[model samples]
Target chain A: MTEKAIEISNLKKTYSGGVEALKGISFDVEKGDFIALLGPNGAGKSTTIGIICSLVNKTSGEVRVFGHSIDKELEAAKRCIGLVPQEFNFSQFETCKQIVVTQAGYYGVPRVIANERAEIWLKKLSLWDKRDTPARMLSGGMKRRLMIARALMHEPKMLILDEPTAGVDIEIRRSMWEFLTELNEAGTTVVLTTHYLEEAEQLCRNITIINHGEIVENTSMKDLISRLDMETFVLDVDRVPDSLPDMKEVSFRKRDEATIEIDVPKEFALNQVFHKLSDKNINVLSMRNKSNRLEELFVRLTEKA
Target chain B: MFSKESLIALQSIFIKEVTRYFRIWVQTLLPPAITMSLYFVIFGQLIGSRVGQMGGVSYMEYITPGIIMMSVITNSYSNVVSSFFSAKFQRSIEEMLVSPVPTLYILLGYIFGGVSRGLLTGIIVTLVASQFVDLEVHHWGILFFVVILTSMLFATGGLVNAIFAKKFDDISIVPTFILTPLTYLGGVFYSIQLLPEFWQTVSLANPILYMVNAFRYGFLGFSDIDIVHALILLSVFILSLFSLAYYLLTKGIGIRS
Candidate 1:
């Protein structure tokens, strides 16, 4: 089997009236990897997804899924992938079971097998009890799950979810993360686009950030975080301090009597800060980033673009 | 003519199209039957009673086949137009477009769906019309062929209209402005032979007239035009309309990005 689940080269899309949505972007997703494609609105993330799914035509490019060219072998390429769009696209009047089974049929799954897969996916997604309910009757979170279940009916090797948890509650979002994690563990390659940076940091091993219709960054999550120039952390101390410890490589200040905040540069280790603070007789109970570190980095990179 | 994926995709779309109208039986199936019944009662019973014999048959009997053909055309055309346009409106068309299904199946599925509805409504109208008068079929095969071909022709027209439709109003424009006018002038209520020589020539230009006359001939055992020639023209028209629809869909006239 090819290690590449998806590969795109020089993908370009110039919509009618000369609106350039995707400006010759290219990337790849290795098999079994959980990846995040992050970007702000109008960054061409959905356009890229649309091109891969054959919903949008590319002016000039090559896209392949598991070594099958989308143009020459679209059915074969599409059969290998599933897309959960940002919006609900299934018929509202259809029952949850009907939606999934119909989706399975589109992939040419046998009716009997479609039925079995419908049951299995619905059960796995905790939607079995609502199988007979019309899709419109499902809550926001349940509808998202229904889309996921429908997408998985064919058991494609790769699944792409665009903002899967946008309107979902935190609890349902966490459960979806767990579900996606389990799917990844089962050897499915997952490419997710989400506004929740915490989601990307928690669930994805690799990240690709697009900005202004181009690939701004494509690296492992760890490597991207390591490249951050600085991170601010807050220290919770055991006792109040009249003055904070002086540190040349770090900027420190007492946010409150018993708490202090510090800006730690990439080259300056937390241990060095701790070492210097301990020398000053300040005992730190717990320390954490003042804000979401990844969020800070994402904001900076996107704004810079 | 299709691969396995294409077949499955066609079946899925066909089933969905079938389910949509059936689910709303009162709205989709009931209106045509009721409308045609009123037509049968008024034109076939009350007004048709005083109108006397038309073409050697009673007025009501003369128009029965024409009315049934009209119902089939209106229903089949409306079913695909409304259904396909609704899919576009709700963005559910993306479900199939984004899938591995071939685009031709999407077209066929909706086409068959409209044909089914049109044919079903034709049956209902035929049964309803039979209540007022005994409909003796001079040729059953011709009746079936003409009705099916007419339904398919208009269904293809509806698909074409839908691909160009941007709003709800766009969907209604063709059926109201173009289709209804054509059907009314197609000799549904009266024979075009009764018209003056010049007006008769104008009526001959209407494509619907051949369909109505051909269908009426199937039931009355005679027609104003040659049955064989009319069948060929109808077939050609159906093929041309289908080709245009297929072309528009492939070009992504309205549904693609």
Candidate 2:
């Protein structure tokens, strides 16, 4: 019975050209919940964020944040919601510190407090040394970090990040995810949209998958993963095998001369496969799960849709 | 908390925009100064010597105020049009739109930014004009009032343009076709008194004519038309345009798509 930070009841949006972006979507995000919105391109992910942020006018339905309706008490709702848009949307002429501080000001935070918060976020993002550089002069990764810092300036109760780490290097992406996870743990409700399923699997506890502007699935990550009956295991061998076990329940693919990818259902026993390998005198080099629970669930759900 | 907080947000946007234009003084401030100086040399000195006095004052003095007002109008209009349109193009406006900032505040922030540039350019052009003519300020209050109102009017117009503009070409169309013709015909080079009777009445319909005459009245305490009527007309234009701009902003016209 935790308090809901964001509640959308049958929210819908339709453009003037008769293109429906959201078709009666309803969901609730409880306080401190880390939810990931997974969807293919043009799956109404951006449209949903746009409506909640009040950047797009809703054709019908309602969105409320912290009990304030976005259409009625928009300022109050917006004050509590921080949106990190997918694209870089900052003035190139302004410095990183200026960008974050200005956004804080827009939310009515005092200049001193804004500057202090900007400093803290910049340091946390490892961008403190580049604070004075104009945003255009920063690398693509730095600009993305600056966008995150700017969104965090107001100390919002709920944060929505749209594709936060797309196009970033792997190391920076992992660090960003860590920072976001820490932020969520510190009591901010986070709703994220990302194309990277692995990142979503690692970070989110609640998951919602949208397809063609409709919420195809909305459930806990554990429940979603459990719904998928399939699992994959990668087995490493010392040498190439001339023939593989012809098991009907498992599918295998060669990964070079020393490895094979095996897909198995959850009901199947892995011990039988291992016994079969040992009987053939194929030494097992290593074995690892090819897909995490979330990945398996996502593949199953998206493919089914 | 609400009023004070909103005021602070408005002030922040205004300050940022002011800083943006001032940071590039060489490009924003200097060009108007140089352009006005050339107007003085060619129209006031070269053309005025042969033409003699206009409205019982030296041609240099008569043309000086109009030239200054012209710079103010163009600068104010261009500043808002180009800046806001560029923000739209870059999608940077999403930052403000997504924040808790009010729509009126966003509109005012951009309008004030343009007003600041227009007033600054007008002041610089006036100073440059002084080097060419012995200017006399008959009514400082009138000069200040007219310049401010004129700047606000054009700044609002610029915002309207920016709201409707979808691309770079949209920014140049009005300035080139409408603004240029209106300013040139609005008694910048010649007095409306010099025009034929039918043309005089036709020129009166141009809103820029009223602004130019009102500003001219401010400097010399004289005008071809009734100065009070001109002031009233300019006020009406400002109020109407402001209302229109505010409505467009609140409706999210051309901004929220």
Candidate 3:
């Protein structure tokens, strides 16, 4: 049987102000699985993460991290998990290295070991040069990376990040994705909450969509993507044909002289569309999805809830 | 007994708290030294020349222990309140809350940090007063016990204040409106013997009076209050405040949702 990284059963949380943030949601994240917990704003994603990390108290629930019950074996449960909160929570005056080393110390890692690990993680995250600089001096991207390095200092078995790339640029976001992929590949159960649906599709093997304090969709990413009834693709062509081609299974429209968009249902194949375009003497230069598949599915699932 | 991991976790928070205060020495460490020095200059020397004797000693010598205790109380209380409140304000306190560190360890770490600052300030005030009067410790053992207990009690009280404080203003309100008045009336400059009988009876209700009188007894070998009762009262207050702070933390009051 596969080990479970996390098991949340019938979790519920109602804030002091009578806001029901979570209403009896249950889920399990398998060990070593790369997963995404995607949700729209105010959809209980953060509350769930906060409860898992012991930051937010739950109304009633049982949470186990690697078989250690959070309510009973709290210390043991916390020891197995590392959390990167949605916001920057370290002291602004502390140096990047100090922030990471101090985090390791909270987990009982010796100073010597913490220093060595801080050096390695900082270097790996491209923050070695900024290690000695105060956290306030770093740019937005560097601060995010510093939080990641700090989370990894104790070498936790599972890592959970809440919107870790919410404000990062494309280049840095892609680099972060690569690093997370590598970390997941090395047997760290990685669970992340992100607004970027494309990031979820690209990195997660399984996805959970939440809305209105409930889980709307929970399944393998492939299964979820397969459920999409239709997809739109933008095809770059050598030139626009004088007249548009007609097809029964696919709808084609001219976006520009060099680009054409096609809505292809699951029953239709791209090869058939290419055959029709070739017959029209329109050569294809490149092709890409018009919209992220998970994004469309995410919107549909969350909107219905 | 604490486990090894808990000890390391305690050490981590303790070091972090110390580092935070030291990092802003101008704001945290310097003010008390400067403030206490001024008190020695104004109240001990200039004013003592005219005020004459108190508690069987020159006014300067009488106020020396009181001044030192005052510095210790204020510095210790302010240190923990400001540091803990700032951590909460910045949300950095979540770092410890999410870790495996026990709540007791967190409490002790910040209290120890406050005690360190308090004792350091006490020493600084004492050294500064030495230039104003012939400083002496009549009973070194009682002096040490009283000073240490006083710091611990105030530090614990500071933690309680920090836990309940929601904003920057909330942290200062207690010190300004309550703590300062209590310290001033706690027999820092004049003994309770000088007060009218009724006012003296009322002053005994003040917790700070017990601490100050006990601390004074350590230096001058005499007190307006019973030394044993004062020690017992100090211990009781410390225990009560420690329990309250621990309960607040465990309940996640004003911190967790």
Best by TM-score: 2
Q: Tens-digit lDDT track for model 2 on A225-280?
A: 77777888888898758788778888877878889888888899888887877777
Q: State the lDDT of candidate 2 residue by residue for B26-103, as single tens digits.
A: 888999988888889998899889999888999999988889989999999999998888788888888889888888
Cα lDDT of model 1 by residue, A3-34, tens digit: 79889999999998799988899999998899
Winner of 2 and 3 under lDDT: 3
Choose 1 or 3, whichever is better by TM-score.
Answer: 3
What order do candidates take by lDDT, descending? 3, 1, 2
Q: In candidate 2, what fraction of native interface contacts survive?
A: 0.77
Native RMSD of candidate 3 (Å): 1.7
Q: Provide the lDDT at B165 for model 2.
A: 99
Model 2, docking class? high
lDDT of 3 by residue, B1-257 (tens): 38887888888888888888889989877887788888878887888889988867998888888889998999899999998988898889988888899999999999999999899889877877777778777889889999999999989989899999988999999999999999999999899888999999999998898888888888888888998999999999999999999999999897788
Residue A123 miss distance in model 2 (angstroms): 1.7
Q: What would the DockQ be for model 1?
A: 0.70
lDDT on C-alpha atoms for all candidate structures? 0.90, 0.88, 0.90
What DockQ does each prediction reach against the true complex?
Answer: 0.70, 0.80, 0.83
